[model samples]
Target: MSERITRLEEQVAYLTKTVEDLSDVIARQDRELDQIKRRTQMLMEREAQRDLDEGGSVPLADQKPPHW
Candidate 1:
């Protein structure tokens, strides 16, 4: 019974450590995603402005595909 209890405790500790590691990974990915989102938004805005400055009545993003 004592050996079983020790095994269970070891398993619990390992699982706890795994959970903490995964949580840290998730947090880091969240921050990276946020940065990517911001950069993408900035690039989109810049592209829109450039399209307007170039005298395009329809922004490229709003245009239909040539196949249509």
Candidate 2:
């Protein structure tokens, strides 16, 4: 009985540590995702600016009518 309890306790401790480790990993991944999102947004904005500089315009079908 005592031996079984000890083993179970050990397992619980290991599981707790594993959960904490996974939580840290998730946090890191979240930070990385945020960084990637920010970088992607910056790149999109830069591309939009480049397009504007080159007189790039949306198609007439895609844009609102001149009356608007």
Each model's TM-score? 0.83, 0.83
Off by over 4 Å in 2: 58-68
Best by lDDT: 1
Candidate 2, residue 11: the lDDT equals 100
lDDT of 2 by residue, 1-68 (tens): 99999999999999999999999999999999999999998997787778778999753545798789
Predicted candidate 1 versus true structure: per-residue lDDT over 1-68, tens digit per residue: 99999999999999999999999999999999999999999998888879789986667677799999
Model 2 lDDT, full chain set: 0.89
lDDT of 1 at 8: 100
Worst 10 residues of 1 by lDDT: 54-63
